[model samples]
Target: MIRFENVTKVYDPNARPALDAVNLEIDRGEFTFLVGASGSGKSTFLRLILKEDRATSGSVYVAGQNVANISSWRVPKLRRGIGVVFQDFRLLPQKNVFANVAFAMQVIGKSRSIIRETVPEVLKTVGLEGKERRMPHELSGGEQQRVAIARAVVNRPGILLADEPTGNLDPITSMGIMGVLDKINQNGTTVVMATHDDDIVNEMRKRVVELRNGVVVRDEARALYTSMIPVVGESRRMKDASDAEIDRAQGVQQ
Candidate 1:
């Protein structure tokens, strides 16, 4: 489970806060979407959850552990339990699909035997079973994103955070990715995604949390990301790539 209680963040020492008094609870096995205009603290919220950035003030708990108070030595282990996918696919330029996914396992010190056996298995889960030898440049954008997903979940993480996961793909490809995420959630991983894709958000019909000016204005058990999404600053890059042009665009990352 992930819980944020009265969480707040202020990036600049002399600037205004980025996130203000956000409170939320995401139960295990549930799929949820975080919606907001750009600069509404959506990215900041994800960073806080991933511990990439600490809250200037407030409490955060993941899997019953307080993230705000976790030891520096334990941060990595905590991240291992949470997988994250960015807007841009972060595959290694020189690595093939197999190597990219196996990379995660190798990082936590998994034995070579397990790495050899487990990599292929996870690839199969994402429907990339036989393309292990293919490089990222050779795969479709959607396919490359799938490889990224495989890498993230290779650790069997209990929580998954995807920020604008489908922003770079077409509607059909977006659905494919969502299907995989839903499947993961079904298998008991908590999913928290930040996105502005109206169709996918509305179609999934999961929990929805909306933010405006860095504060949550709405929270619903079953909400759809529609025209109602808050429109904030540079965050309006929602239409960055249409499905037709997505394949031509390179992946982006945080």
Candidate 2:
């Protein structure tokens, strides 16, 4: 459902590319993990799929449409087919869980009846059926993230992109989030997640693509994390870059 052909993204003329000549493909219904240390181009990889940042060179196709060929006015329509969840949760503080999930459909001009029917279904899919009234601050970290997941999938997007979804949660909580993601993938949404959680990566034994300094060092259909790589400062730095990409995309849409 996703393909990148010799993609390279250079932020500055004087600096190296965030993603260098990376060619990858993710099939429909496949769950893949993009695992790498911070600054290894994981975030950049995800952003390219979202069209949040265009590759400096090459092509990115999502579900047969080349994102670079999609016009600015049509970006929202492109985004509607993909759901993105970030490490930050990115919830509206004042909005309750139901409103937050329902907001996605509302922005897309879904009918009140459709929203009413859809929101509860997705909430139940993410195991958040009874917590619709809870505000972001009122829920636990895992629960808040579940709400975020619910929001992402309410529209039943063809692809799900999660960036460090478990970075902020405890081990047990992270496992729970992974379970929810797995469930989503099983239900037939293509899932591509970028994460630094080695233990989770090793345990899940899914398709793994490891990037190092913008190069795809490893791509295995099934693999472990190989080693414990400590990327203490890089995670936050990469996340900041991803956040900036989101802000830029929103600014353009506005």
Candidate 3:
């Protein structure tokens, strides 16, 4: 439900583009991984999808609407259908787990009855059913992240954008978080995650879109983190469309 057509993003007129002529399409009910090194345009890709920034050139479409053309007043409406989880949990320190998740629906004007039902349901989904009253500091890192995930999905968003959701946790904890994300995808929310965790990527073997120097070098479907490929941030952009064609021919699914 997300498409980018020849998209380029340049923050400064004189500098190189953060994203250069990137073309991508993420279908509904699919989970994709945006894998790249720092400054490889992974975050920029996610931001464009979120409408946090506009592409310098080209179009960004989410859920069938061109994000560049959408009105600012409708940005919130657009975001309401999407959930976001970050590397940092970003939980409200002063609020308990239940209040943190409930706040998401409350801000959208959900009824108390709805909030009461959804908060607990989402917490349970994230495996935090009995820890509702715990403060942020009282929970472990993984638990805190679970609360953040619950908050993001409490509204039942159709798309979930996770930017390094497991970056700060241990391997075991990260696996737990990944399982939660997989479960969410199984429930039909399109999941696009940006990460550098090779173990996680290789283990999950999901669709991987590898970026290097702000360009897409590989888009491998149901692929492992193949060490045979160029290392992250070290791969140069394909010489031409033919290069990408070769990658696709090698079973790199869209």
Candidate 2 residues 1-254, lDDT tens each? 99999999999879888998989999999999998778879999988887889999999999998999999999988899999999999999999999999999999999999999999999998999898898999999999999999999889999999999999999999999999999999999999999999889888999998887787767787778753343346544755575587689789999
Deviating ranges (above 4 Å) for candidate 3 = 227-254
Which candidate number maximizes lDDT?
Answer: 3
- What tens digits encode model 1's per-residue C-alpha lDDT throughout 36-74? 767778899889988999987889899998897898999
Q: Give per-residue CA lDDT, model 3, range 1-254, as digits (tens).
A: 99999999999879878999999999999999998767879999999999999999999999999999889999999999999999999999999999999999999999999898879989999999899999999999999999999999989889999999999999999999999999999999999999989999999989999887688888888876544465444344343343575577677554
Error of 1 at 89 (Å): 0.8
Distance from true position, residue 54, model 1, in Å? 1.2
| Error of model 3, residue 83, in angstroms | 0.5
Q: Is candidate 1 or candidate 2 better by TM-score?
A: 2
Q: For each candidate, give its TM-score against the true structure.
A: 0.88, 0.88, 0.90
Name the better of 2 and 3 by TM-score. 3
Worst-scoring 10-residue span by lDDT in model 1: 235-244
Question: Which RMSD does model 3 reach against the true structure?
Answer: 6.8
As a TM-score, model 2 comes out at: 0.88
Task: Score residue 71 of candidate 1 by CA lDDT.
Answer: 88
Off by over 4 Å in 1: 227-254
